[model samples]
Each structure stands twice: as structure tokens, then as C-alpha cells.
Target: MSSPDRCPVVHFDHHSPEHAADPVGAYRKLRAEHPVAWTEAHGGYWVLSDYESVFEAARDDYTFSSARTSYGGEGLSVTIPKTPMHLHIPIEIDPPDFRKYRKLVNLITAPAAVERMLDMISHYTTWFIDRVIEAGEADFAEIIGVPSIVTIDWLGLPVEEWSRYSSAHRATLSAVADSPEFRQAVEVDLPYLSKQMWEVIAERRLNPADDVISFLVQQQVDDRPLTDEEVFAIVDLLISGGVGTTASLVGQTLVWLYQNPDVRLRIKDDPGLLDRAIEEFLRYFSPTQALARTVTKDVEFRGCPMRTGDRVLLAWGSANRDEAGGFENPDALDIDRWPNRHTAFGVGLHRCAGSHLGRAMARSLIGQILERMPDYEIDLDGLVPYARQGVNIGFHKIPARFTPGPRRLPRDDRSG
Candidate 1:
């Protein structure tokens, strides 16, 4: 057992160029040598790379808090190098109050509710594909427009502004905080989004609609109704969640399928195998890589002294690939891996409420591609990956070519 002051230390920076270059290789090294090592980056924190350590820490919310700032109290944010942004309700708030916000969000995003949107998800996916099918080649990263439209439509925001949101978010997540791209997103794009959201929120207050905005405006917390700030925060969180990660997974999976024609052929021949394949992809190429939690008290965790307010990064990507976690040939992408308990959507009370929706959307987007562009070939040399993979691993551009095809349905047809 290592003493509090004599624990293993490593100079690991998740946002560094080295990490972005080869994330899995970097994490694999950490898991093998120092699963629970201390790092001096981002004002210092512990990186939990092993499956058991991350799983246990995530479930023990009381000890490892997610609060950006405790409800009505002073605390640290979830991110190691906390971003200057609105509170991500439910995720950045601990239980009790966390449940209140989570429950409200869940009311609309539950599995059954997402099931209701499968056709809609498929419709948008097909529509996006239609735009590119005739061209014979496309920048596949533009598939993000599907989720952007779906998310804004769900929130009752103007769907035409989907590209703005998608591009801004992609920029924000792909760059380090100090980078010019990140600055542009934070200073320019986010403010515009907030303004637009506020306007819609005001409109929803007077004339409610059958959408999330109206639903949120009428909800109450504790004995009183939620304020405008609270409403904005929740809505912002939803947009952030809805727009980015699923699309990242889709992009990564597309690249993987292009490289593995055998797996692609199998999935195309039997659509039933897709869900399992998506699971394996999720485990293998975790989009949302690591999320941070603040230690609540002084204690020894995984044989290291964790003082109060110390940031601990739970490396979900590493955990999924942990061989000791019972994942045989952990580095390989096994589409048939059953009972796969990967933490891609995280674990415990703070597990993503939109997991069902994300999975369904991935299904529709990727399934449509396999069906429509069965012989598509990626331009690997032209691929442009994200400059940073600290929080998410994704591509900025995935250029590909396939045989041209006719549109399956009219653009304006909801039932198409």
C-alpha cells in the first residue's frame, strides 16, 4: 500500500497532442502500469484507468461528487479544468436535487419515448443521406446535421439553425480550452445560442407547445417553479448532450466499418447484428472519453490519499478496454460480445438519461448508411480527426465515395 505522500505519479495530460495522437495507446499504457496514478496536469488530479476503480468511484457518488458547485453551496465543477459555462443540471449536481432535474429530463427521454422517435430518427437520417446519395461522394461528418435537427426539433427550437449548433459544438469539443477554436466557440457561438434559446423560452412561457421548452417552463422544483436560469441551464445541457456524442460515435463507427469490410458485410446482410455491433463500437471507441468528479472528503481511494475537493478523472475509455475487467481480447472489436457492461454511457445515478435516445439515433444513422451506401469506401488519407480527444474522440471530416443512388423519399415528407 502506498502512503498518502508517496503514491505513484505520472505526467499525463489528457488534452495534450500526444493524447490526441493515440488515445487508446496512451490509456493502455496507464492501465497496465499505474491504473490509479496521480497526475500534475489541469491543476493536479488522479486518473482512474482501471475498470473496477472507475466503476466504484462513479457509483459512490457521496464520496466522489459530480457537482460543479454543490446545490446552494460552494464546490468544484465536474471537469478537471472546468470550463466557463452554465451548470450542467443532473450531471453536475449530486443526488436528491440531482434526481429532481434528472426525473424531469427523463420524463421525455425515456426508452419508450425514444422508441416513439425511432421513425423520426430514421426519417431525418434518410433525408440527410438523400442529400448526399446523388453526389456519389460526401463529407460524412455532415451527418451531424441529423442529430442537430432532431435535437432542436425536440426542444421546439428553429430547426434551420442546426448547422450552427453542430459546428459550434464540434469546434468546442475538438479544441483545447486555450486554443483559438475553443475561444471562438465560447465567445461567439455559445452566446448566440443562449440568446436564441432565451427568446424561445420567453415565447414558450406565453404560448406553450408540445415540446420540451414548454414542458420545462411549466415545471416546478421543491415548492417553487424553476427560474429562467435553471430552465436555460437544463436546456443547454440537453443541447450539449444531444448534439455531440452520438454523432461522434456514428463517425467513428463509419470509419471502423470502412476498414473492416467483413464486419460491414455481416451487419449489412443481417441488420439484427447492428445493435450488438454498436455496443462493441461504443466500448472500443468511447466518444465521451473521461469525465471528472470532485472528492468530497479526505480518504484513501484505490490505495491513494484523495483529499477533499481533489479532482479525479474517471477514464471510461480505458475501463471499457480493461482486460482484467473480463473483456477477453479487449483491444479487438468483437461485435458478438454479450453481456457487455461497458461504461460508455457511464454508470450509477449519474448515468446518461438520454442513453436510450443516443442508442436509437446511432442505430438509425448507421443503419441507413449500411443500407444505402453498402459499397461506400472511405478516403482514409483525407480524414480529418479532432485536434483534441480529452473529452471526446471524433473526426471533423470523414470523406467517402459510393455509387450514386436516387432519393428514397421526398424532403418534406414526415412519413417518408
Candidate 2:
């Protein structure tokens, strides 16, 4: 033994029950005390906590190389294929290969392109709220899960499949992102995901539409039309990212808002405040947590030596709460927070593709909720906020009670 005081490496078995059952207290020590500590577990990976380190790690891909595709300046972990036919499309390819899929993604997630989906998004937003209003009480996970579920609607697919996909995605995430057990399980479900995406791709190929799937099927990269497997793989990546991250983030947002009424009232008073609040929430909660990368060569992060071929982990979620050079009271919910340089969606060439839309959807919901249910209060006893030890961070359940507020009743006696 090297003795307790000199032990530099801290290993975390994130998949352990303790990780989910209780994390804040478990994580607080690491977040504050060990900002750039290395980990002995998870195949001897490093754990980055401070915002500067995490952001630096995310931005410097050469040092913290991604396992997948890189966007304008961000990247995600590559989904390791257990079997040969497991599939590695947009997300598994790095750099040049990553860029090819990124171009197609940029076109679909563009402001104008997303703008076209606004009406549908808003319609579903209102409808989502109405579902809760009629019930008088609801699990925000199921009711306000529109922005994510409806995103599939944008793909010209049945939103009804959300539950199944959600289940499979969560299972797969747990298997691959959390522990070896989940990885083994993921091997079984991944092929099924490919089949599902193939069905959608085939439908879009026969009848091309303005939808993303259709655009993908008709797209050509490197003078070659993307293979059906490639298209399906990309689709699977997009679907999983949109639904999983958004759902968890939204669910976490609701619970946080309910817990902090002062922040809630600010948005309720000035609905426009959500423009900033949405960003702040993403910064504060940072539901996606950490992502992994491989070290291409020996490098040092802010004086810390990192070796080549090392498995490094970027704790994006915890970084947002670092005491030094990070957020002030990073743990608190501040709707008016600015200069909030939190790396929630990540940084570098793989920054989140649908970040703008995620903010828009969040803003839209905050607007609707404040207007309709200003007096809404979450059931603290029933507030089963999401607690995950792996891939994403968010709510599994957020029970809320919607109470009608004082408002003028519309006069419709003779209205046509």
C-alpha cells in the first residue's frame, strides 16, 4: 500500500447502486477537492472535475480525442461495437469521417429548418400542457415529454414508439455507459436498434419528404450515397441523443424549478427571462454528466501530466460546480446567471447538434407553464427526481400538482 494520504487516484464504479441512490454527497468531495484527479477504475481512466480542465479537455481533441464524430468544436464518445455488425455510423467516426455526417446534420438542425418545425413543436407543447391540466396532476416525464417525443414526429415516425425506444435506450445506456453488464446487454439490443432505423430509412427512400430521415437517405457523402446501414446508424445516434438527453434534462429542470420557487417566479413574472434561464439550467444541471475519450499522445492539462493512450474521462456535469474558475455558487439555480461559460452540451468540435432546439423547447415549455399554472407546486414527497450513475443525469419522475390560478374568464356568450 502507498499509504492513504498519498493516494492520487480515485476510482468510481458509477454503475454501483450507491451512485444512483445518492450522488450529490458522493460527488461533492470529488468536485471540490479533486478537480483533475486520475481514476484507478474503469480501465484506469482519468476523472476531470474543474470547468477549465473539462472544457480544455473537450476543446483539445488532439489531447482528449473523441471516440466519435466531431461537430463545429465538440464531440461525443464513440459507441464501441461488441460485434462486427454492431454498427458505428456518425457517432463512432472521428474527424474527417465525422465531418461528413456533421454536414448532413447541420442542414437538418439549422435554424430555418428547426423554425419550420416550430409550429409542430408549439402545438405539441400546448397539447403536452393540456394533458397535465386535465389530469390536475402528472408526472412531467410523461406529460411534458413532448419536445423529445415530438422530435421523432419530425422524423416522420410514430411517437408511440417512444416508450419502447426510451426503454431500450436507457437499458443500452446503462449497459454500455455504466457497467460491463449493460455493455453485454447492449450487444443484444443494438442490432434491434439497427433494424428499427433500417425500416425508417427504407420508408423515407421510397417516398422522400422534407424530413430529416428523407434528407439523410437522399444525401451523398464523399461522392457516394450513404449506405442504408450508415443512414440507419446515424439515425439511431440522433434518435438516442435527442430523446435520452432532452428527457432527462427537462425532467431535472422541472424538479429544480419546483424546488426553487424564487427562480420559478422570475420566469413566471418575465417569461422572456427563460431565454437566459434555459441556458443557465443546462449549465447548472448539466444532465449529461461525463464523457470519455482516448489520449492520442502524451499531454499535460494545466500542468497535470497525461500519458499517451490513456483513457481520460471528462466530468462535464461536475465541472459546472467547481469552486475555482468555474461557476459562482455553481450548485445554485440562478435564472439570471450570465457569462455562464458552463460546458453542459460540451465544447470543441462535438458541441451538441440540437442545443439551440433544446433551449427553444425548454423556453417554450417554461412560457406555457408559467402562463397556465403559475401556482403549480411539485409534490415533494412524490418528487422522485432522476438519479443516474452513468451516461446522463436527470429525473426519472417529477410529480407536480397543477392548480388553477386567478385569471379573468373569457366571455364567450355571443362569441363566434
Candidate 3:
């Protein structure tokens, strides 16, 4: 057994182009050799590649703190290298205080609330498909517009500006850190998004409406109503959380389905099969791949020495594919895989609150593609995936061709 001072170390950078290209192969090798290997990348951290370590660390939030209280404090930020942006509430804040903000968020995105929005999700899905039905081609990544529109519309932001927010967010996640695209997203695009959010917040303060923004503006935290900063943090987190996640999953799954016409036909023939297929795809793609946490104290975890203020990354993507995660053929996609408890969404308290909404969005968007564009074919040469796969994985563009079809818009809803 390795002592606290001399645990195994490895060279690993999750955002590296090589890992992005073959993340599964990279993780498989690491997990096989050292499930709890230490790495000196991004100021040094540990990577938990196996299922058990990742799942337990996520559950034990006290030992693995998520709070990013200060730049020079014991508290560590969730993202490696830390972000220049404001702290994301709930996720970045720990329990007790975390639960306070999460309560409000949960109410906003509860399963029932998301169920109520299914019609809207379907409508927007139809609208986007209508745009390209006649042309028989689409940059399929644009389907992200569906979730983008629903999220902003639910937040009571201008529904029409969904494309701007989604585009900026896509660029931000898809680009390499400090690159021109990244700078544009952070300095230029994010500022625009924040400005728009704050504007609506101001409007809701005086003229509160029946929307998430108004609901948040009127809510309390720590015995007082939320401040502008707090409100922005929450709203920003929602947009950041909702915009790219489901869209990425849907985009990747679409590509997979195109390559696996047998599975695609099976899903189209039996609509019920899509739910299980989605679960399998979630495991395979793991759109929200891994998340970072700060070790709270000096301790030996999984036989490795981890000190207070040390950083650790729980590789949810790797965990999903971990052989011991109790799935048959762990590396392959199995729509029929039963009782699949994948950690595509992080486990424990921070397990994505918007999971139901995300699933619903995927069902509407991908289901429509399989139904409307049944014979869609991807332009493999034109496909563009994100350059870096840090915390999220997504495609920049996926050009596709399908037989031309008529717009399926409702007669009275021809506003698109």
C-alpha cells in the first residue's frame, strides 16, 4: 500500500486534445492501473477514475468541499484552474447554505414543472426542425436552440435571444482556455448574457411576473431576500447548466444513431425504447464528463495521500464506464441494459436538479429528428467536435442531410 506521502502520480490533463479524442481509452488505462492517481496538471490534483471513489467522494461533500468562498482561503472552487466568473450558487456553495438556494431551484425545475413545459419543448423542437425540413439539411448542433429557448423562456427572458445565449455558451465550452474564441465568449459574449439577465432582473423587481426570474427576485436566502449578485449567480448557473448539457447529449446521440441505423430503426419502431436508449447514451457520452472538488482535510483516500486544500476531480465519465460499476459490457452502449445507475450527472447532493428537464428536452428534440428526419445522414467530413473537453463535451457543428419534408407546424402556430 502506498503511504500518504508517496501515492502514485501520473501525467493527465482532462482538457488535452489527446484525451478529448479518446477519453474512454485514456481513462480505461488510468483506471486499470491507478484508479486514484495524482496528477500535476493545472496546479496539481487527483483524478478518481473508478466508479466507487468517484461516487463516494461526490456523496461525502464534507470531505470533498465544493464551496469556492475566496481566492485565498481553504475553500476551493469546483472548476480546475478556477473560473474568472462569479461563483455558481448551490453547486459552488456547500450544505446548509447550499440547501437554501437549492430549495428555490428545485421548485423551479421539479419534475411536475418540467412536465408542464413538455408542450413548449415539443413546440420549439418542431419549430427548429421546420426551419430545415424543406432544405433537407441542418447544422444539427443548432437543435441546442430548443433547450436554449425553453430555459430563457422559463426564466422570463426574451425568448427570441435564445440563439445569442446558446451560441456564446457553445463557443465558451467548445473553445480552448485563453484562446481567442474563449476570450470572446468570456469577455464579450458572457458580458452580453449577464447584461441581459440583469436587465430582466431589474424589470422583474418592479413588475414581477409569473416566471422564474420573478420567482427568484422575490425569494429569500439566509432570512433576507436575494441580492442582485445572488440572483445573477443563480440565474446564470441555470442558463449555464441548461443550455449546453442536454443539447450535447442529443447531438452526440444523433451522431451515434446515424452510425447505428439498426438501433435507430429499433427506437423509431418502439418509442418506449428511446428512454432506455437515452440512459445508455448518457453513460456512453457523459456530456457533463467530470467535476472538481477541494479536499477538506489531510487524509488518506483510496490509499492515496490527499492534503487539505488539495484539488480532486471526480471523473463521472470514467465512472460511468468503470467495469465495476455493475453493468454488462461496460464500455459499449446497451439500450437494454437494466438497472443502469450511471453517473452521467454527478452523484449525491449536486446530482443535476434539472435532470428531468434535460431528459424531457432530449426526448422532444431527438425523438423529433428520428420521427421527422427518419433517414437523416450525417456529413462525417463536415462534423466538428469541441476542441477541449473540460467539464463538458459537445459538438460545434454536425452537418446532416435528410430527405426533404414539409413543415409540421400547427396551422395557427405558423409564427416561425
Candidate 4:
């Protein structure tokens, strides 16, 4: 499998453990060793990791485009085709077209809106902890994970059925991701999830309330309300995006803290320092790993040639960790890391809309957990079974045990 001209390695299989264990390692190697590498695996595509190359891909929609079409008029399976849910989401669109939807999304997810939900956020954080804090140890996923479903579902989703939707979400990504097994899993679950969303959308329409669903059920766009299908499309994105991604961040970040007591101590002593720490965590431990795009025109990026019709995975995890990539130390978690531009929520036109809410939920949940029960380290073994996979990097399980009695956290101060 000869790659395009001026390329380096020809990775034979995309699902190799080497690719799985440390995805960024492969990308870094590509950036350093093969700035314009091509992989013949998974129906063929290109990997662009050079800092300059990715930046170009993000900005130049004409050369490195977001639309799922190619100037070459070829149907390359390089990128996953957009779904119905994408139509209502400006996140999947580009520029002016994306703005119409993004403005509404931003309005609802604005920082001020986050402040308004502080009481609910605080209450949930405390409520979840109060349930399992006494047990001395509990699975953060099940306790907090299940609760997220409840909170989000009340926001106008049928989240009580997460036991079902969670499986569906995992399966759909698994299908398109690294394995044939996951693809089979998707076959059995995706339709069910879609159907459930349809049913719930219908129910919410007939009977509206003060929740987010009602807000949408009657929301007007230029004096006309959204269609049921459009409403479901947007809500579906939230269903998959909101709860699952936050759970992953909370679980993974906890595990990271558990491994580094020094870091944990830093959080324990200066609770206020948590806000900055959470930002750095999102940068270093970006939950969303990669987003794919179909190249729409011929272009040369980072000095490597790109074809008109090809698939490119903007491996964010790799970009965030790149040593030469103009951010702070990509490898370490510096609580005071400022001017951080890691693309955890992505860059350019498709930036994540739910990010404010995501950060708020994660910060509040993690802060409250350590605030009340500071000495518990996480359990990684149990998470193996239910941890879902997708572009969003996440964990399936996190078990933490309190070190018994009045857990001591770092006080108002600690040396950085």
C-alpha cells in the first residue's frame, strides 16, 4: 500500500494496540518522522499531525474542508457521513451556516447560564456524594454516572433508559471505530437509540414543561417553531455529548489525581485552585480524541501533498500533547498553566457548544468529591466492562475508597 508522495510510514492496521495504548505517540512520531503520513488501514486515509498542517486544516475550509464531499467526485469512506442529529447541530456545519445554530446553543450554554444552574449543579454534586460518601468507597461511574443520566434526562431526555442508550452510543462508535465486533454491536443498538429518541421527542411535544425539552418543543426560529425531527436531532447530540463526556472526564481526571498525590495534595489544600486545574486537565486529558473530515480540494499542507478526496483525523490528543506545539509543557499538569490553547473542545468553526456546561459539571463534581472526601484514590479495574469508546475519550468505571474519617485536604495554601 503505497501512500501519497512525500509521505513516511504506511501503517498496515489501524487497530493495533500501539495505536490504542498511546495514540498521540503515533501522531507525534508522524509529525516528527512523517509530517504527512498516510495509513492504508481502515479503507485508507491520511494522518496530518504537524502543528502547521493541523492549523491549516482547521482554518482553510476551501482546501481542507468540513463538508462531506470531495472535488474529485469520489466516494471515499474516509470520514463518517453525517447523521440526522448533525443537521440541527451547527457543530457539524461550517462558518455562517453553523452560526445560526451555534448562537442558540451558546445562549443556552453561556457562562451566565452556568451560574444560574450553580444551585442545581451544587445540589447534584452534594447529593451524589451524600449517597455514597458514607459507604467509604463507591463506584464513581454507577453512583455519579447514573445520576448524570437522571439530571440530563430531566433536561428533556429519556435518560432513565441510559442502561439502554449508553450501550447504543458505545456500540455505534464501536462499529465505526477500531473493530468489527463494535460494528456488530452497533447493528443491534443504534436503531433502538434513534427510535427511543423519536418516541421521547413525541412525548415531550404533546406534554411540555419548563425543562429544556419544552424550551425546544416550542422554540421558534424566525417565528416558526422547529420540527419534531429537528428537535430530536439537536437533543440527540446532547444526549450523547453531555452526560457521557462529563462522566469520562470526571472518572479519568480522578484516576490521574489518584496516581499523583502531589497533584491531589495541591487540590486538597487550595480548593480555589481547582478551577485552573480543571482547565489544564481538559487540555492534557482531552476527552474527545479525534474528529474526522473529508478533504474537499487539492492542497499541500506542512509541505506534504493532500488529495482532493481523502479522510483526515485531527487527532487532538496528539496535538495537545505535542512538545513543539506552542502551548505550555504538554506532558505535565501545571495548575497554573495559563494561555493554554489545547483543542479539547476543538478549534475553528466546529468548536464544541456544550463545553461550558461540560466544564462546569466536571469542575463542580470533582471539586465537591475531593472537598468532602479527599483521601480516596480511584479503582481502574472495575471500569473495564462498561467504559464506552468514541471520539470522546472516557472511562467506564472509577471506584474510590475514603481513607477513613475527616478526610484531610490541602488547606488554603500549598507550594506549586
Candidate 5:
């Protein structure tokens, strides 16, 4: 019968350098001692550290609504200090209406549709690797980041401006809470990006094509085509969702493989194990660490009372390591670990639509690296992590040196 006034309180900052350096370790400690501790940071929010709590909360979206409006009706605030942004399409919307927007985007991001992009993913990966294969040394982030944006470019959006979009998109992800950089990106970069999307949307309206933008422009919701604002919101969702995270996964996993040569050797020796390895890496080091959900109604969860509109952070990284959550040796990285129901891509209605695309990109990038740079070794001393780490955990720089190789793909093979 613990009440909100009596529950244990902890001083935990997800963006702190200590947590950024090793979030798993932080979660391991929290889950053991204070599985549902209340934190004072970002205006006081409950942090669910154990798998059961996070999983249950995520499943019961009604109780813990994903609506960003729960905060102040400003926009989809997934973080504390609430970044000044607009609605992020389906993610910021609740069920019923949420499904409408999701259905439209899902047409392209579905597993079958994503599978069709494998060839293009391979081509993009080859294009990126070709740029660095001969240099012997390269920043893995740059190598992976550009191609990821380009892949999304092919999905719809102007390919000519992939670099600009990629830079702004990455900046938006890595920006700190209310920092100058974050403010600039939110105020400047996001609007600019949205305007670019609007241009594409306008173009698609006049001349439809076999791309996401065209589909969005023509897709009807409840017997009517989506409005301009709706189209822009969907584009915002897709662009933000498409970039950054996959690149983070590829870059982070490459660093992990380099650190653990035995695991690297095993994967290199048996390429069939790559899929499992990717899953294991995802569980071990979740890129999208935590997401915020607003309480829909007052309720008691695990002896703690929650009021409506209260914000809670679903620690996906912590849940992945929760032993009681069906994972054995939760801390250990077992590429072959079966029945691994990790929440790396989250769960319930709001599960990531671009998950399949993300996996394809990761697999493609990893395969390309292993094939072309089998002996690539990361400069451990040069590795740098992103400054802010609440939502996304990734490396800013991962410099590696490998035996030089010849380019296999032609430069003109850019378009899939």
C-alpha cells in the first residue's frame, strides 16, 4: 500500500554523462533497488525500470496515453522540458485516430514492402562502403548515416538534398534538452525540413509517382484526402523515424563487434548468424532508450498512484535487461538467445512502423562492412558518444581502420 507520497525517490538523470556512458549499468542498478522509483528531473516523472512494468504500461496505452497534448497541448513532447515542436503524426496521436494515420504509412513500411528494398539497401550500402573502402580509415557514422538518409530519399523526398536533411535530422536527434543547439534545430532545422517536405507534397499532388510522398498525398483517411498539415506531419514522422536510429544501430553494433572480436569472428565466419546477432545487439544496446507517455487517468500501478496527465518514462533499455521479464542472463549478449522478446522497437499499438526498414538497413550495412572490411578495427580512444542520451543512445564518432579494398558498385548505381 505505498502511496505517491511514500514511494522511494531517486535522483536519476538519463542525460547525465554517467548514464550516457553506460545506461545498461544504470538500469541494472535501478531495476534491482528501485524498479519504480520517482525522479525529480524534468519536473518529476516516474521511471519504470523493470520489464514487467514498462511492458505492461506500454501495452495499456489507454492508461498511459502516448498523446503529447497531455503535457500542455503544445506538441508531441517525448522528453522533459518538452521541445517546442508540432504533432508527430500517428506517434503523437492516440488510438482510433492514430490507426488512420498509421494505416497510410504502414502501406510502405510493412514487412513485404520493406523486403523489396533489400536490393536498394544493398546498393546504398555498397555506395557508402565504396567511399571509404580505399581510404583504410573512415568515420563509421558518416559511412552509415549518409546511406540511411539516401535510402529514405528513395522512399520519397528529394535525393539531391539527402545530405542537408541527414545533417539536420541527426542534429535534431542528438540535441540536448533546451540547449542552444536543440533550440536552433527545433526552431530552424525542423521548419526548414517541413517546408522541403511540403514542396515534395505539392509536387506529388500534381504528378503522383511510386513513392511514399505520392502515396501520402493521395491517401484518404475517413473518405477524404489528408490535408497539407497532415501530409507534412506524416513526412515529419517518416523522416525522423527513417534516419538516425538505424545509423546509430549500425554504428553502435560495428563498435560492439570491433570490441568483441570473438563475437565478430563468429559472425564473420557464419554470416547466417547476422540476424540473431543484430537482435542481440539491439537488446544489449538499445538505441532508442526511453520514450515518454502521459497518464490518461488516475490509477495505482504496482502500489504507486498515478494522476491523469502525469508523464512517465518507459525505459526500453532497462526492460531489455530485466531478468523477471523472461530473459535469462539478461546482461549477457547471447546472439543465439531464443524467445528474446525485447522491447527494442517497443510494443503494443505504437510499435515502430519502420522497424523492418531499419533491420534491412542494419543488416545491409553490417554485411557490407564485414565483406569489405573484415579486419576493420575501431580506434577505441577516438570513440565519442552523443551529448544528449535520454531518448537516443548513439556514438557521435567511431573511427576505424581496415585493410583497403576495391569498390564493387558503380557511382551511378545510386538509384535503386
Candidate 6:
């Protein structure tokens, strides 16, 4: 056995282009060799690559704290090198305190709320699809990125500035961590978006509207109206959570479907199978890659000694592909696979609160794409995936071509 003081270590760069291109293969190798390996990247940390370990760690909040500033006097920001502007609510806070903030935003993304947005989602999806249906070619990311912004706008932000905020959000997703572009997004773009949200908050306070911003402004916590900071935090969380990730899923799903015509035909023939197919896609291509948790106590997990203040990465993508994690033929795309308990939306208390919204958006968008542009073919040579795949895996561009189709919208409806 390896000495407890000197555990086996491996140098795995999760952010490299090679890993980003084929994260599943990279993680599969790691899972086979070192299911719990210590990496030297980002000032050294433990990486849990197997499903059992990752799931367990996510559940044990006491052992693996989610706080950016943990009780052990160390910052446990989810991203490596840490984010410059790190004030994401609920996700960044631990239990007891996490419950209040989570409750505030839960209703916004609950099933009923998301169900109500379906007609709006379908409208926006059709509107965007109509723009490219007659073009014969378009970048799928650019085409699909707008609807989420429109959804957020309806939720009580400025719809007119959707382009600006959406661009900022997309830039942040595509850029490498701490890069100039990423830094600009964090320091400049996000603050500007926050300012806009604050203005909306001010307006909602006086002239309340039937929107999320107005609802948030009127919400009380502990017998007091939620403070400006709390409200801002919630809105920021909504903007960040709702914008790019759903688009990424839809875009990536398109890329996958275009490549696998057999699976595409299966879903196309049987529309009822699309939901299960979406779940399989989520399991296969876990968009939000790995989330960080700080070790709160000294513990020996899988023979690796974890000290307090140590940051451990729970590789959710790896867990979804684990062969022993309850799924048969883990790597294969089995759309009919039932009881898929994948960690695509994460697990335990911090499972993505926007899961309902994300699912609805993805289903609505992809369904519209299949219906309108069923013959669309991806330009394999023109595909461009994001360079970094640590926090979020998404496409920079996915160019595609299709037979020209008639515009679904009337000329009057086209004029925005």
C-alpha cells in the first residue's frame, strides 16, 4: 500500500484543449487508473472521478463544504484560480443559511413555473428558427442563444438589451478562466448587467409588474423585505444560471444528433422518445463539468488522505459515464434507458435549481429545430468548441446547412 503521508499523485490538466475535446476519454483513463487522484493544477487538489465517490462527496455537505469561503479559512471557489466576481447565491453558501436563499428562487424555476413558460418558450424557439429556416445555413449557437435571454427579459429585465447581456454571457462561457476576455466579462460586463438589473429592481419597487423582479422585490425573509444585495444576488444567479447552459445543451445535442443519424431518426420517428433522449444527452454530455468542494475535516477517502482546507473537484461528467453507477452500457447512447439517475443537474441540496427551466428550454428548442429543419446538416469542418471545459462545456460556433424552408412567421410577426 502507498504510504498514507505520500499518496499517489497525477498531473491532470482539466482545462487543456485535448481534455476539453475528449473529456470523457481523459476522465475514463483517470477513473480506471486513479479514481481518486491528487492533481498539481490550481495549487494542488483532489479529483474524485468515480460515480460513487463524487455522489457521496456531493451529499456529505459537512465533509465537503460548498462555500467559496469555507469554515477552514480557505476559499473554495468552484472554478480553479477562483472567479474574480464570486457572489453566486445558494450555490456558494452552506446549509441552514443556504435554505433561505434557495427558497427565494425555487418558485421561479419550479415545474409549474417552467410549465407556464412553455408557450413563451415555443414562441421564441419558433421565432429564432424562422430566422434561419430560409437561410440554408446558420451558426446553431448564435441562433439558439437568444431565447434564454428573451426568457430572462420576460422574467423582468430589459428585453431591449438582450443582445448585449447575451453577448457578455456567451463570451464568458467561451473564454478561458482569467483570460482577458473572461476578465472583461467578469469585471465589466457582469457589473453592467447587474446595474441594469438594479434599475429594474428600482422600477419594480414603484410600478410592480407581473415578473420575477417584481416578485423578488416584494418577497420577505425573516419578517423583513429582502435587502437590495440579496435581491441582486438572486437576480444575478438567475441570469448566470439561465442563459448559456441551456443553449449549450441544445447546441451540443444538435451536434450529437447530426453525427448520430440513427439516434436522430429514432427520436424523429417517435416524438415521445425525445424527453428520454434529452436525459441521455444530459448524461452523455454533462455540460456543467466539475464543481469544487472544500474538505472540512481530515478524512481518508479511498486511501487518499484529505486534509482540512483541501479543495476537491467532484467530476460530475465522469460520474455520469461510470459503468458501475447503475446504468448499463454507460458510454452508449441508450435513449430508452430508464431510471437515469445522472448527476447532470448535480445531486443533493445543490442540484441545479433551474433544472425545470433548462429542460423546458432544451425540449422546446430542439423539438422546433427537428420539426423545422429536419434535414439540417452540421458543417463538420466549421464546428468550433470552447477551449476550456472545466466549469461549462459549450460550443463557440456550430455552423450547419439545411434545405431552404418557408418562413413560419408572417411578415407582420417578423417585425420585432
TM-score of each: 0.95, 0.84, 0.95, 0.84, 0.94, 0.94
After best superposition, candidate 3 residue 307: deviation in angstroms?
0.8
Model 3 deviation from native, Cα RMSD in Å: 2.6
Worst 10 residues of 5 by lDDT: 72-81
lDDT of 5 by residue, 184-269 (tens): 67778778867877787898899999887787788899898899889887777777777888888888899988888898888888
Whole-model Cα lDDT of every candidate shown, in order:
0.85, 0.67, 0.86, 0.64, 0.81, 0.81
lDDT of 2 by residue, 1-416 (tens): 22232235675645456767655555677776676776654445666777777777777766666654231123235321111223445545568677988888888787887787777777777766765575567777776567656677777665766555665565565443445545544565556655766787898899887677888888899999988887777776676677777667677777777777887887788887877888788877776777777777767766667776666667777777775645688667777778787788887788888887777777777777778877777776776544445557665667778874432223231110
Q: Worst ten-residue run, lDDT, model 4?
A: 407-416
Report the C-alpha lDDT of model 4 over 1-416, residue by residue, as the tens digit. 45556355466233455565566566667666775677766556666665566666777655555653543233322233322223335544556665666676676778887777766676656656666665788877665553355446446655456556655554444234435645544555556767766776788789886567677777766568878876776676666666666777777788888888898888888888887888788878777766667776677766657676767767666677776667756777787888777777777777777778887788788887777778887766655533223255655557678854432223332111
Better of 2 and 3 by TM-score: 3
Per-residue alpha-carbon lDDT of candidate 6 for residues 165-220, written as tens digits (9 for 90 to 100): 77676566558867887887878887888787788888899999988989989998
- Residues 25-92, candidate 3: write the lDDT tens digits: 99999999999998877767889999999999999999999888543233227767666666678889
Record all residue pairs in model 1 with backbone atoms less than 3 Å apart, i.e. clashing.
68-77
Off by over 4 Å in 4: 1-6, 12-15, 68-88, 144-147, 174-189, 221-223, 379-390, 403-416
lDDT of 2: 0.67
Candidate number with the higher TM-score (1 or 6): 1
Tell me the deviation in Å of residue 304 in model 3. Answer: 0.7
TM-score of 4: 0.84
* Greater-TM-score candidate between 4 and 6: 6
Task: Write the residue-wise lDDT of candidate 1 on 1-416 in tens digits.
Answer: 22347268886999899999988999999998999998877667889999999999999999998877542134226655776667778788888788888889899899888988888788889888988899999999996578878888888888888888877766766677667888888899889988999999999999999889999999998978877788888888888877889999999999999999999999999999998988898999889999888888999987888888777899999999998778999999999998798999998998888888888989898888999999999999999988888887898899999999989888566422
List RMSD in Å for every model shown: 2.9, 5.8, 2.6, 6.0, 2.4, 2.7
- Scanning candidate 2 in windows of ten residues, the lowest lDDT window is 407-416
Q: lDDT, candidate 2, residue 282? A: 85
